[model samples]
Target chain A: MDLTVTGLSVRLGKRAVLHDISATLRPGRVTAILGANGSGKTTLVRALAGLAPGEVRLGSARVDTLDPRERARTIGYLPQDGAVHWDVTVESLVELGRMPHRAPFAGLSAEDHIAISHALAATDTEELAGRLVAELSGGERARVLLARVLAGRPAWLLADEPLASLDPAHQLGLLDRLRALAGEGMGVVIVLHDLIQAARAADDVLLLREGRVVAFAPVAEALSPDNLRAAFGVEVMQVRDEAGRILPVPIGTNR
Target chain B: MKRSTLILGLTALVALLFLGSLMAGKAWVPPSAWFTADPRWWIVAELRLPRAILGLGVGAALGLTGAVLQGFLRNPLADPSVVGVSSCAALGAVGAIVLLSASTPLIIFGSAMLAAAGGMALLAGLAWRSRSAVAFILAGTVLASLAGALTAFVISIAPNPYATAEIIDWIMGSLTDRSFSEVQFAMPFIAMGCVALLFTGRALDALTLGEDAARSLGIRLRRTQMLIVVGAGLAVGASVAVTGVVGFVGLIVPHLLRPLTGARPSALLLPSALGGAALVLAADSLVRLGPGATEIRLGVAMALIGTPFFFALLLRMRRSAWI
Candidate 1:
């Protein structure tokens, strides 16, 4: 089912963080929310995931109306920080993703094990299965954490700043995986800072500027030079190949 | 080793320490005496048996509380004693001893448990108000010191020197001269608290991903937090009411057993509880076997044992990204 956010506004201690943001994230499509720092990207994602109080609808059902467990099963959320406090193993950490699907007191079932293994293999974290999370590098940790969220197999996945800690190669690899996940009928919504990465991976785009959505459209339309300048205060020069596809890049900030 | 194997090993150790504690006192009771009309049988049944059982129960309680508190607060350094919950309970017990000496043990137990619940409520509130880990721990330290001062004030104002001494001895934490009544008083509360905490294993594991993720995982934040606070308060309060403020078993046992339990808070709970029971029993035995005619207090012995371990953990944690 497609995830939709409508008339969503969130106030953090009297200061508005997200203001009347609305977007329809289509299934089998990767949507990237692009915004300047403090422009409510994280708040918007949270509101969509029902982590923040707001109006979110999963197809026909209002998200907030659903019970938390039901909401959890529908939407897999990965927070900005991928830090796990304990020195837990990668396999154990990934297994926690099955929490919403399994009974609280019941042991993991055969299906749970299958999902966990699939997540491990999908994220290419099988080699790090027995290794402690504390011992892994930043990029490795991110993949393992993503695997943790993936093991739930939610219809919609919301990730906030997932690409922040990853290196260039890992970043491309994870983006490819997210795109592949979207192709498999899961709606993937990610908050990204890199315009180039977002332009390359996202099929749809939602641009926010100071808690307001400037545009929510196809990547080609939403990332127009005028919209980019308005949303990010930058004159971005787009480079296209002979086939007229945009090679996403920002030449400079307009100050 | 597998968590099951570790739990089994710890259980065996607890049994051994329980038996050893029964044998370690100023006088030893023979196995034959257990079934005979020997006066030593009374010692075995009445005195030594109660002490050993209380130590095991109280230790298990503290250890479980420590593990839960660490997970709930997301701070590895959190302990009932260090975070001031134990002192708050002690304050309640001390108040009862000073003013309500004529009152029943049940009333005192109630007061201690209530005060502990209040303290935990306040600490959890402080933690909620501020998301900073440093603020949470500092608030706990302040609360603990405040409770400590209040307990001292109550002791100072006792009606007689003997009463003051009695209060001091209790605060020092001894399994000495305890009867079956004290064990009877604490066991139910501890068990109730433990049952509450035991069910929280999955919630705690979900929490390792942090509050937002845990909430997104359908772990009820309010319910989980309530269970942890009330459960830890009940368990630690009951234990403190009987044994005074035994420090660090909660901190030490969980830290020691976390590796064996895969460092998963859920997996750590049972082993930590078993390890805690063993640690308490062994420490109680050491108190009995020590050189001094006046036995070393259980709380003091634990502090001495646990402080070094705490430093070692701190140093090791320092080398990594624990903070």
Candidate 2:
């Protein structure tokens, strides 16, 4: 499903946090919203997921006409620091993703159960599926979160830094799984800080600064040092081996 | 191993306790009166039976309301009384007696309902302003303290010092001297309150995951907040109206059962209610077993038992730290 945003603005009290921002979520690709802290990356992600209370203009297409629950059925959202009070098992937590798809006071159908099982398996968290969330390590928690987002079987999955706490192996594995989700025609949008990882994971990049879209295009063109410095005030020297790919090279001897 | 059997077992236990409460009262009725006694059978049917049910009813209300408040506010210390619902009920009951000069039961019941509503209104406002649990709870504490001091002040100026002593006991809470009239008067409100609170189960479960998470789940913040307010207020208001201001049942019931139920507000509600009933019934029995006609004030009776229970709960939590 195609999602569109037009002429969006965010004002927190008196300060204008996001300007007249606009973007389209292209299908079968990972779109990265990259920027420094407080650069409106999270806000833009939040807006797309319909969580933020700001002026939003969605298309008049069939998808846009769907009810909020119907929208939730297809649009998976993973908020930053999802709140949890008690220690529920991983399977039960993932099952909550199906709430929008089912009617109230009704148990999950067979298909819903299948989807939950599939999500747990895909995230490679089946081993820890019985564990309580509170008992899991930070990296384990992140994996469980990914499983939860995936369990909804959404057409579009929006995650706010899904890999913010991963070690190298799980990080690469999670990116591959997300790419695979997109390969199945699911649109994935992630808010990311590590530029290198964003370039490696996403098919396209959408850069933001002060809540305004700075770039929305292919990873190769948008990851340019010029745009990076313009948005983040950081200098970068591009590097590459024989593959003709750009590698992020940090400048200044801050190390 | 079987769920139905477990439910049946619990039901049986509650039934036995309920039966004991009816037959064990001061007035005795013969076994023949169990079926054939005329207006005199009212002792069991109208008086002790409803009182026992109220014990269970109020217990459940306090417990479930406590759980919802703590989950909604996300504060471990978020007891219902701390927010002035009970005190407000006391103020209303006091007003009904001293100012309105209403009937004995009406004065006891009406004022409690009014006071509980007042306390809840203030709490609802605080919650709306910040959606922060700790802030709302602290606000509740402030209001509760204010209500408590006001209760003391009102009693000090009471026209009859002898009546003041009785009023003090009522404020502290009691089922003493209660007849069928008190039981009949309180039944409907408590029943309505329990039903109202049950509606909050879904919202509370969603809320357990936190506000941002709940919002993303397509549950409106304002709507959920409203359900919580009305449900909690109704249940608490009805409970305090009938029983004066019993303390800590809400605080302790949910605290004990949270681990078993996995912190989902949906699952916690009924269990907390059941647990609360059991807790209060046990506490009431303890009071009954104690010496003298100056029956230990119900509120004080609960406090004496609840204080140690609260400490034990904390120590248990400390041992099982992660959850």
Q: What is candidate 1's lDDT per residue for B1-323, written digit by digit as tens?
A: 88778878888889988988887777777676786898888888989999999999998998898888787667788787656778899888888878888346677777787778789888788766554445656767888898989888888789998888878887888788888888888999899999898988988898898878988898777777667767877788899988888989989988888767777888888888888899999999888887768899999999899889999999988987768
**Could you give candidate 2's per-residue lDDT for residues B1-323 as a string of tens digits?**
23344335546766666666666544555456775556657777766666677787778789888887776776666777766677777877776666665547866686777777777788788767665556666777877788888877777777776657667666788766566666666667666777766776655655656665665555555666666667767777777877888988899888777666665666776777778877776666556656665557668988987899888877876886443
The CAPRI quality class of candidate 2 comes to medium
Query: Which ranges of candidate 1 are over 4 A from the true structure?
Result: A241-244, B121-145
Which lDDT tens digits does candidate 1 get at residues A1-255? 878888888999989998888878899999999999999999888888887778888988887668889888889999997768888889889999999999877989999999999999988899999998888998899999999999999999999989988889889899999999999999999999988888888999999999999999999899999999999998888988565668568888887
TM-score of chain A of 2: 0.92
- Per-residue lDDT for A41 in model 1? 92
Candidates' lDDT values, in order? 0.86, 0.74
DockQ by candidate, in order: 0.82, 0.54
lDDT for position A108 in model 2: 83
**Residue B229 local lDDT, model 2:** 64
